[model samples]
Target: MIDAANTYEALFVPALFQQWAPMVADAAKIESGDRVLDIACGTGVLAREAARRTGRSDRVAALDPNAGMLAVARSLAPGIDWQDGAAEALPFPDRSFDVVVCQFGLMFFSDRDKAVREMLRVMVPGGRCAVAVWDAIENAPAFAALVGLLDHVAGRPAGDALRAPFALGERQVLATLFKGAGANSINLTTCKGAARFSNMREFVEAELRGWLPVMGVVLPEPQIDRILAEAETILARYVTADGLAFDISAHLATCRRP
Candidate 1:
C-alpha cells in the first residue's frame, strides 16, 4: 500500500487534480455547522477545501493511514482534526459525522466493502457520502494520447509502471460496492477539467514532480523515457492559442445511507 501511495504522492497529488478544490467544495454541499469526516484524505486536498467550504476547520476530520501524507495535510490545515487510520478501521464512534467523503482513495483500499461499511458506520443516518475517481484513461483522450505515445516510444515496461487505481473507472463495479455498503440511493455525476501547461517542458515537469511515483511503478526506466518522448508529441496536439491543454475526466459519486 505504501508503494501505491508513494506513486500517488509523486505523480498525481500536486499537479494532477490539486486544483479541484472548487469542485470538491462545490460537491461537498457542506453546511456551516456540519460535522464532516474526510476518510483517506490524502494530503488534505479535499479536507482543506471542504473546511473552507464549511466555513471552519474544526468541523472537519481528516483521516489517512499514511503519516507522511497526513503530515502534509496538517501543515496546510492545522485546525482540522488529523487522524492516522485506514478507511476499514475508523477510530470514531458510530454515526459521528453528518457527512463523509473519500476522494480518489476508494480504489486502493485492500477491502473496499469493509471500508465502505466503515464509512457508512461513521455517518449520521441520512447523511451524505461522496467519493470521486478518475474516469478510465481510455475515455480520457488527452491522457490516452500520451499513453499511446509512451507505449510507442518508451516501450511496454515504462508504460506499465504508470498504472494506479486501475479498477476505479468501472461504473458497474462501483455501483455494486455502494449497494453492498447499504447505500440504496446513489447519484453519479461526471466532471470534466483540464490540466494546462505552457509548453512540453512545463508539462513534463508537472508530471515528473507530480506523477513520477506512479509512473515509476507502471513504466520501467526505458519505457518512461519513451513515454516522456510521446508526451511531447501529445503536447503538440493540445497547443492552443495560448498554451498546451490536458483535459481530465473525473467521476463524482454520491450516496445516501438510509
Candidate 2:
C-alpha cells in the first residue's frame, strides 16, 4: 500500500489532485511560518505544498485515518508532522492551527457534522479552511463511466466505493454542512479541471491499484479483464494516442470559523 501511494502521488496527483491543493492553500491565505493542518491528508499532497509556501519551519502537519497512508505520507514528506487520526475526532488540540485544508476528503468521514465541527474546533478563531468535493460523478464523465462499468462487472460494492466520495456533491448540502457547524462567511465555488491519464489503460491501472477508495475491492481474475475491456471501450472517446483527458468538476468551499 505504501508503494501504491508513491505511484498514486506520481500519477494521479497531477491528473486528479495537484491543482486543487494550491487552490485550497491560496484560498486559505497560507503564509510563511503559518501553522497549517491538512485533515484526511492522504499522502500529504496539500500539506507538502503548504509547507513549501510556509517555509521549512515545520509548521505543517497532516493526519489521516489509515496507517498505510500515513506511513507513505511520513516517508515522502518527513518534514511535516504526520499523525494517525480521523476527521470526526482530530487528534490535535482546540484552536491549534491557523489554516486547515482538506482536498476531496470530507465526504468519506463517517460523521460529517462532527467532522465539520471538529475542523472548526481544531482551528484558531476565524481561521480559514478550504475543502474540495467532487461536484457529481455524472459531471465527471470518465469516473462516472468507470464506476458504471465496475458496477456492471464487479458489483455495487465496487461502484459504491467510487461513488462514496461524491456523496456531498450538492452545493446546498455542503453549504448547510458548514452553516450548521456555525462557519461564517462560507463561500462555495466550482473548480473545473481535467482528469488526465496517459491512456485508458493507465486510467484503469491507477483506479484499480492506486486509488485508495476503490483499491481494496477484490475482483475475480476473470472479472478484472472483463471490467477493463468494457471500461476501455466506454472511455475510448476521451482517449488519444498521447493520453486521455476529461473535464472534471468539483466544489471548492472556503470559509472562516465564527
Candidate 3:
C-alpha cells in the first residue's frame, strides 16, 4: 500500500498545494530574517517555500499533529524545525514569530476559533498571518464532479470527506473566525489556482489512496477500481492533451496582531 503522506506529497502537492505556497508566503510578506511558523504544515510545502524565501531555515518552524506527515516533511526539508503539535494549542512562546501561515488547513482544525486565536497569540504585536482555504466545492467543477462520484459510489461519508476541505470557503465565515480570535485588519482575497493530474486514474487515486483514508473512509480495492473507472467518463471534460486539468480557487485571509 502506498503511504498516504508520501502519495500526498507526490500527487497533491505539485498538483494542488504547491501553487498556493508562494501565494500564502507573499500574503504574509515574509522577509529574509523574519521568523516564520507554518501551522498544520502537512508535508511542509508552505514551510519549505517560507524557508526558501526567508533564506534562513533556522528561522522557519512547522508543526503538524500527524507523525507520518511530519516524517515526510522532515525527510524532504531537514533544516526546518518540524514539531508534532496541533493548531488549537500552539507549542511556542507568545509573540514568537514574525509571520504565521496556514495553507489549506483552517478547515480541518477541531476548534477553528481556538486555532485562529493560537495563530495570533504566537505572533509578535505587529506580526502578520495568512491562511488559505478552498473557496467552495461548487466553484471547482472538477472536484464537484469528484464529490458527486464519491457520493454515488463510495457513499456519503467518502463524499463528505472530500467536501470537508472547503468547509470555510465563505469570505464572511473566514473573516469572522479571525476577528473572533482578535485578529486585526483582516483582509480576504480570492486567489485562483488549478489542479492537474497525469490522468483521471491518477486524479482519482490521489484522493482515494492519499486523502480518503486520512478522513477515515477507506474503500476496498474493488470499490476504488470501480471509482477510477467511472472517473474517466465522469471527469472527462477536464481531460486535456497533457493531463487532467481544471480551475480551482481558494480564499486567502491576511491579518495582523495588534
Q: In terms of TM-score, which candidate is strongest?
A: 3
Q: Model 2: per-residue lDDT, tens digit, 199-243?
A: 887788777667734347656668878877888789989987679
Which scores higher on TM-score, 2 or 3? 3
Candidate 2 residue spans exceeding 4 A from truth: 212-215
- Per-residue lDDT value at 49 in model 2: 91
lDDT of 3 by residue, 31-85 (tens): 9999999999999999999999999999999999888899999999999999999
Estimate every model's Cα lDDT from 0 to 1: 0.73, 0.85, 0.92
Please, what is the TM-score per model? 0.83, 0.95, 0.98
What TM-score does candidate 1 reach?
Answer: 0.83
lDDT of 1 by residue, 1-258 (tens): 354454445545555667665665566577788899998787787888778777889999999887667766777779999999988899999999988988878877889999999988998889888888877877666666655564566565434434454457877778888998898578778788777665665665444444545335344556556556666666677777766767777788788778
Candidates 1 and 3, the one with greater TM-score? 3
Clashes of 2: 0
Best by lDDT: 3
